[model samples]
Target: MAERLIPRQALEYIKNKKLRPAFSYKDVWNEEHAAAFTVAKTMQIDVLSDIKKAVEKAIENGTTFEQFKKELKPALMQKGWWGNKEMSDPLTGETVTAQLGSDRRLKTIYSTNLRSAYQKGQYDRTMESDLHPYLMYRIGPSLRHREQHLRWNNLIRPKDDPIWNSIFPPNGYGCKCYTVAVTEARKQKYERDGVPAYNPDTRKTVRLPVQTEAPKPSYRSYFNERKGTLERIPEGITPGFNWNQGQSGRTIPVLQECLKKAQNEMPEAVDSVIRTLQNSTIYRDQLSDFVDQAYKHKIDGKANYKNTAPVGFLDKKLTEFLKTEGIETSGRNLIVLEERLILNGKYSGRHTDDGNAPIQQDWKNLMDYLADSPVYWDSRQKKKNLLFLKKITESRYLKIAVDVLSTERYLKLPKVDTMYYLNIATENEIGISEYNEIMKLKKIR
Candidate 1:
């Protein structure tokens, strides 16, 4: 296939690997040179280094299969990397060949590189617009195609559809299958152009599920390539295809959806966001608390510090809190603490409730201890995390909250509804008029 047919999205992922392959998995789990564009472990590092340069060049230029074989053959031969031998990979202790000139190998290499690039590109295109939620597999017109992957042909499912994670195209060796982004428009277009293969019987189209129950091992199985760390596939991705070409840096479409919601009014959408942990798995740990303390409890601009951290992981959730005032974390110890602050304080959102009120003096004493506490005094660099905790406990808003919870009006709200609304109103940082409106609700509601 020419560069034009090589597939752009696949190139997007491959392009990322030019600097560093963005995945790691167990060597034993590597079945059939997974993402062959990556540096091979079987070859000596020095030998692989020369070979990688040519491979990278081919990828950069979109060299066709023939073009790659012609250019790389001479280089591999000159370096005496052309012959095979019984070999063991120093890294994984796996047996693989270092042979460079097999025609079959070149063709396989060409197809693998070009095909993966194309598929990755196609997947990305689906994410670029609102039109398509599902990708439909298209069987390439190869005569001897594998049967199992063929069974997936004409199937259209969501980008996040769990099956898509493990069963994306190229499901096996020499697999000649491709996927097309499917949208309502395309589905209709196909109906007009003769019933699409998706509905071979020409019956009414049936919508697919957004999620599939996790398959039983009898139905399907998944293998994880774990060495030291569980191979971190792209947040929601599957195994084997772990090493990202270059696509990880792109903004995720799902996250974009969240930001899109932010363009409107109050932070209700984000409050349900859960703000921490796995990108693939939707969660809501600190989000509820953030909503409670800042949105639910209503901190407004009352958090301690007159400036935000100048250096550290720039996160929107934390930055949202740094609206007008926050400390500039400049000192080395404080800067280290800044990272911890964002990690824990930024999202580790907490609030005081009437019945659950903390000891007001307890927080006061902790603040006093921190005021006198030296930075980096301990062997473990915990000063950064401690610095964040100190700010949260010492916030004037929190102190007042501890006192407010002790009051009868707040403490005696027996029903959760009463408590919930009160927290929402106060934590939401409403103006005096809104606060008065809430107060009037005490009489009206």
Candidate 2:
């Protein structure tokens, strides 16, 4: 019962809730060791010397050796001590001799040296004068038993309670761990002395004792590791350097069928869009104000008005306004904002009256408000408009779909539409024609 229940019961009885079972002596020693290393190095004193002095002082202050070991857990952890293997008697499996802590192993040797120095204590006190007491004071807490508990508390969680589950596994006696101290300076020294050096002037070199040849990586591994994420690929192809190229293709008839469906659906779509536009009070007013401004620009063209007409002037002005609103302006004359505002998992697209991308569906929503909304026109007229609008819409959606499919293997195809859109076009050809009397609708791109 004591193995499990005693720890919990004793911990509960202790006034300091932090005195728990899981927080073991090893943990305390580790923290103190770390604190000692930090404080000693920060003071720029020899760490080993400061540690010995601090230990002697603690012993004089009446700290039992066993209790000192328990408290030194934190410092040991900080100092980076790693306990070496133990040598045991083969017959009994009991170790007769063990090299434990550095202090434990060196205690006898240190005593012999101290005794030799004792005779010269008054005549030549090297130990007393050489030891830095002030620097030791800074790291004093890390060297003492109570200071060990303080550091352990700082490291372990739930400072007010013991966490028994976190304890290290118990092992044979004298198998205590230790820490090792290593600095960047030491590493640099090792690099300088350990590595072979070559003299370029003499064309001679010294070889290292332990030589190593780095493994050569495969071509595939090298290519993958050095590949750029954003590199562009050929049309209808995704950017991948794999042997088998990725391609995107759909049956030509399927594309034609999708085209037909897009046309069939546009009358209702356009009518719906026009209604929304007519109903928007703010949008209607904004559109009117922009058209008026563009018309003014057309009149100012005067002698140059031959190329610049009122309709052309309105497209550019409206497009500029759209740009200010964060709508992507791709082509000079084409303004496409293919965003859907979702409501209850159902979406309605907004587009311009002519079936272009910018027409807000709100215009068609105003169809009830406007009695003559082309949406309410005869089915024959609506069908004609739908066919034209479908042609344009399918062209745009095709570009998107083709680009997506191009990433798959074996579906590669030429992106004729994508290239057409990518070509350079003069202002008039692309839709930025100056305000003129003979306003003509630009060709579908």
Candidate 3:
């Protein structure tokens, strides 16, 4: 038999997507959380809680549709959300009860959750594997189909195509549709030798150009709405299904690469330094949890004197610099944050907890490290003859240099390393020690 065009869904995939999906809820008027249909809230406190619990259980240990309904029904009934009854409302104290549990409502809840979860899981896989750049839309063989769905049945677009971000599968109630990521090689092959087509005359499959364009409805093509914003879902998409599944999976950057595309830098939104390094290039299998705790010291916050703060190289060349400093070699990973070192009262021990040793760098004397650190290169703003890293290196491999703010300089307990903060600070804010370090590293040549 010839190679099939439609790839069969992996049997295990249903369980996977059932556990995770990109969920975006907006009301009829496009207000988030306030939307009529939401995964976490369905306009009923009891119903919402029950559904959330059921969903969590599904994610925790894959639950069947029957199992979910069996567990959800009784809980909802006990909470007075079963099929509609009137009582004192919490918000207005008015006695009002709307239609609660029904076959249709339960069906809606079940399908919506499964669809969104699958979509998100697929999108995560798509992002992880950068090979497939195109997504092919496939509509089900349903007898009753939306005309628009039929029009978009066989449409294929680039993965980054704006249209895919706006519209994907399950665009309406009971709509059975999905997309498959197509590889570049497959795209080239199909373009060169058109897909197999049945020819009446020859009685055999013949090559024909695969369709690229389709009729897309003009209205409501995009929605940039947020909470409290009244907007409408994109045309031809389900009311609560307008948000892009893939983009929704573009969650807060746990790894550095995820933030590479960000317009503004938000470090606080990142995962723990140790977990981040574990997933990223900063990992050391032998170091364990200490791998993260070792290099993580706060560069911006005061070292609180009692508790330690996090910090690091915070650059792509961190490993390189560590190698050059002879501090972090291939097998030996010993870059402890300055806060981890003991300051006073020498105690009997095999290895001293001092960061000021030949191998260790003290957090109290961070300026010393900065003075000898590598220079940054700026392609967008650099002038050819400008001087940088004059006291450190002749090269400028980085664009940004950090400085400690003067107003925020003094810690309750000051140490030579504790003078500068570890975060992004400007020249005006730089304390004397930090300013001197900057001058040493990137002054006018």
Clashes of each: 25, 56, 25
lDDT of 2: 0.24
Residue lDDT tens for model 1, 1-445? 2346554555545543422221232342332232233433324455555555655567667776688788877776776656665555555667765554466765765666666666667666776668887676667657666555545656666665545545665554466677677787766555455333344466556543321223322232344534433443432223555332222323232333333444344345443342322231111211222223332222354443211111112133333433323423111111101112222231333423332233323322322322222221111231212112122222221111101011123112101111101222234442233333333321100
| TM-score of every model versus the real structure | 0.46, 0.13, 0.48
Query: Which candidate number would show the highest lDDT if scored against the true structure?
Result: 3
TM-score for candidate 3, please give it: 0.48
Whichever of 2 and 3 has more TM-score, that candidate is 3
RMSD of 1: 16.8
* Candidate 3 Cα errors over 4 Å, as ranges: 1-49, 56-64, 87-96, 188-210, 214-216, 221-233, 251-432, 435-445
**Number of the top-ranking candidate, with TM-score as the measure:** 3
Q: Write model 3 residue lDDT over 81-185, tens digit each, in one string.
A: 656655453444567555666656776777655565565556666656789888777666565777777677657677766576557766777777777677888
Ranking by TM-score: 3, 1, 2
